[model samples]
Target: MTLTFAAPTPDAIPLHVIDQSNCDAWLAGQGEQVSQWANRNGFTGAAGQTVLIPGSEGSVVMALAGFGTADTRARKRFVLAAAAAALPKGTYKITSGLTGRALEIECFGWLMTGHTFDRYRTQSPSTALLVAPAGIDAKRVEVQANAEALIRDLINTPAQDMGPDALQQATEALATEFGATCKTVLGDDLLSENFPMIHAVGRAAEKAPRLIELNWGTSGPKLTLVGKGVCFDTGGLDLKPAAGMLLMKKDMGGSANVLGLARMIMALNLPLQLRVLIPAVENSVAGNAFRPGDILTSRKGLSVEVNNTDAEGRLVLADALTLADEGNPDLIISMATLTGAARVAVGPDLAPFYTDEETHAAALFKAATEVADPVWRLPFHTPYEAMIEPAYADLDNAPSGGFAGSITAALFLRRFVTQTPYMHFDIYGWQPVAASARPKGGVGQGPRALLEALPDMLDL
Candidate 1:
């Protein structure tokens, strides 16, 4: 909990959650001074509105946060975080207007708002402290917060410090944390392991390309996660404009999110056979870089035509997905910040995923709504399979026409997984602006929803 929460004690200030419907009655019960203070300050119980009441001794007596109306609650996911951020540096206990799932959600959201990535530069630590709300699992909240912080730190780091080698190091460290086993097929060893496409996509980078695998949990349903670890996408030979490259430090966000989700699973001791596969690479340009029109054979033995060198994410992920499928896991899920079209399709707020299973889709959608980690299901769209097929090769790395770019990219990755129930996430992986619990920077999408839906999805 660190500075975000203090140990429960009798001296903590009482924090009340008020809504518009009950404001009048609630105010009357508070007596004259508290009621007048709130009314004079224009605190009418609107969402995110906060008013701190003072005592006769001139010290803080209590705190009040408006939960607004049902409509406001529906529109906003982490409404309480705004109020949490406004509170003074004191330990407070939530005393009213939240319980059960509602209390948990609010507490989790508020805890998330406490996260800050202050690696390269120092930032002020979160000062306001909270007593863990009753009826909520405090440890679970801590686990989720720490996992998210790990993702943010990884993605927010510059490419020089967070390249393929750094990603592999992080994986090994996580494995060590959970007593798991890690094995990496590094550099040209990917060639010996039949990961030709991975090598082709990352061979030009100063940091060698590798496939990082971490395994944990020996006694439950098999869940394999594959993430695209393109640490920096210079767009290879095709090249992105300077503006496009500005946020490329977050290009490995898919891998960061997978690691974050893995942390949650491992720390919570979820009943699952967990396997994480990260094909770590940097899409850099050099004389020996794979160029457009090059045909690279993947680990699955599928020859792919490189129509655009910038589409290297799918190239590396292809080999990794093939390796994951070979393990015959119950499910294979791949996450990638793969295309601009995904950002255009759902913007940065909603995570758009593809899954062929109706049962999994229904569970995931329901869990997403419940957890407020919104996700939309885009179809596998089997009819569009032809778009990725090229005459010269079995598949095209980047299909032409640019229509349904995200769908085509998903379909392209799908070609590598043959036996597992597959799900693919085309995530924007960045928050363009700060909103509620979500800060602006490399953000995680789909992972939280997937965590909630896993029991049902794996039939555990």
Candidate 2:
């Protein structure tokens, strides 16, 4: 469910945010009884700790939350959830401290805690509401938080309920909301449309393999975004282990994240010709499944040898990226849960991205640092170009030896995208553990970072 904001009522409780250094001084000003209460409870103001003060009639009068000091790393985003989870059910207002982006993060955190995917079961909606803090843009916080909720919901859904057809429905719904146009090339039509690689990877699935395209905006620079939308990957003939297949439902997280980004852009009315290409498919096993060692031609007309059927994300992405590249837009971004090597390199929290453009690199890092959505840059490494090239075809879907697997995967995709400033993000998409505002489920990797960087990159 979407979390919304409203004006504070008289019954709203005041949430006082404090740090270890300021705890003693602030308690002293509250008089002896309040100071004694804090001392008795041993509330030294550690981060993520909350204390609810009670009134004479057995109702909560005030609440105190610890923001901690600069050394606490995870204390950055969604810190206010501690108070939200601890307090009694009621409306709340921040009485002091926290302004600008910090305040926005706190408010957003409260909403995030309320977002739970109860598709199979029902969850009690959170009555603990947060009134938007002073000097903060309430509408923007609501939009971004709702967008994040949408991403998580899409990612958390089971593959049975979220195949290529379902992804197309989601895309079309988003288009309907923004008055954009959406078209789909499905089933055997993928071959007629010259997207052979996409069809090859998804021909065995129950749902038809398709490409979902969305277009919005009439003026300004052309911006194309491509997302790898492999709805469910059983690894085709190559196959993954039982454990690996467990989380395959989240394989389409790239599409979910980009759609979330698109929602934010359109809601805010960013001036640009926005185009989104999602090659939605499911790699299932059947009599007709594409086999290993098969050579498939891409929309770019470059033949790729499928060394591993499990490496299907790139096969589908190659065709979609080629289509986006044809427009020669100012910038093209491809986000995907493409490789495990990326997780081994930087883990899940820090998303690994590749781009040779110096200006784009600088802007990406700056935006990530500013918003606390971390991303690390991996080199395009021309030396690794030879790794993706096998003797038989123009590219090898899976390189041998697997020594820079992520880099080689990026290189393979880089072949499809020529010039026009391309950026590829090898994202994990799934949050292994819960941290601050981010729950332990499907999460948006680079959307916030890109959102912060795009306006400046486009000179808007």
Candidate 3:
């Protein structure tokens, strides 16, 4: 997490970036001394290749990285991270042209590459600190890194230690750090407090479902966030097959993401009243578990017919959204690892968000571009509303037809949100595989993009 930028000097170790087309020219410009040394040392700029240049004093003087092609600048952002992975353990600073957000992102990339889910065991090759650039905000980089780390830690923990109560504790801890007010309506209290849908979905689990809330900031605009916290979705009575249940530990990704976003907002001290609502529950099967045909009443007073127990994310979100809407917030954004349909539609890396407000959508899209945390917008097609209709309830939790699964899920949640300019993000919080900058584990999606976009959205 430590980043530093220093002035390049001959005495300083060099980091040479090389592509196939530029490698020879770059070496030739260094003149006979360095070029002969490079040639003798068998250095060639092949992708993923690295070589250390020895100086006359037998000291490591320069490190060469291979890019292999001219059009690799798009991938150049990961160069520092790649170097971090390959270099000997120590501190290093950039000696070349890396500035602005690109520098921050490269620093972030290196930090992320160093993340390890070692909750149950030891991790080797600990992260090496990189000296950040001068004049850059070290606190800001720490804020983002800490937030993302919180998400990964929460999501990486096994369900045994990360159940409903544990998740609530995590939020409470966050609230304490930011001087925010924290509260939880637990167990039967959810029903007494009018969170019937949340109670219904969580009643079957031994952990007992509840709503966790945290409020921060003095005031500017009222912005509320709701996240689905299905701790471990066994798919309830409709029971998911073994394969579907394997990664169920990450079902609470929505809640994890919300907390992650909340951390960023509070850390940056964004000028707004921020309220975060997370409905924490373990959607497990039991004799008392709400049946598939059961009609559950939401806090919004809308009746929801349970068509599929596996679609419980929206059910819990409904009550949380209603509670958020009651506060009459200017904006409400909800994130959830809600559907496989979302993955089918947009894949894992890119989350799909639904917002009726065009201006807000544009702001988020612009932010995504600026931050490189991309998200795509899916329409709130009014015509698709019919798919969620039920014979005996205000709406069905899951639509019968399979078309636009992600869209129908959004449409279902929209019924509960009446006034606020709301946006629903269906995010796959788990990275199925690792990349140069992104490791394989829990990821905090959209929050960085949202944070980057917020000042513009609020015209601050």
lDDT of 3: 0.83
Q: Return the lDDT, model 3, position 354.
A: 95
The residue ranges of model 2 lying beyond 4 angstroms of the native Cα positions read 55-59, 74-76
Query: All models: lDDT?
Result: 0.89, 0.88, 0.83
Which candidate's TM-score is highest? 1
Tens-place lDDT digits, model 2, residues 1-460 = 6678757788888888877678899989987876787788777677777787777777877888887765663535667676677666778889985777777777878887788878988976456788777798788778888888888989999998999999999999999999999999999999999999999999998899999999999998888989989999999999899999999999999999899989988988899999999999999999999998999889999999989999999999999999998998999999999999999999988889999888888999998887667899999999989999998999999999979999999999999988678999999899888777677889988887898899877777
Cα distance off (Å), candidate 3, residue 301: 1.0
Candidate 3 C-alpha lDDT tens digits along 13-115? 5566576677788889888987887788666776556677777888887777665564665644455566567767555555554567766776676666666
Q: Write down the worst ten-residue block by lDDT for model 1.
A: 1-10
How many residue pairs collide in each prediction?
0, 0, 6
Q: Give per-residue CA lDDT, model 1, range 1-460, as digits (tens).
A: 2324569989899999998888989999999999999999999899889899999998888899999899999888888888888777778899998988788778878887678878777775446678998788888777877887788888999998999999999999999999999999999898988999889989999999999999999899999999889999999999999999999998899999999999999999999999999999999999999999999887888899999999999999999999899999999998889889998998888889998889999999998887778899998899999999998999998899989999999999888888899999988888888878778898778777888899999987
Which residue runs does candidate 3 get wrong by more than 4 Å?
1-14, 18-21, 37-47, 67-79
lDDT of 2 at 75: 39
Error of 3 at 192 (Å): 0.8
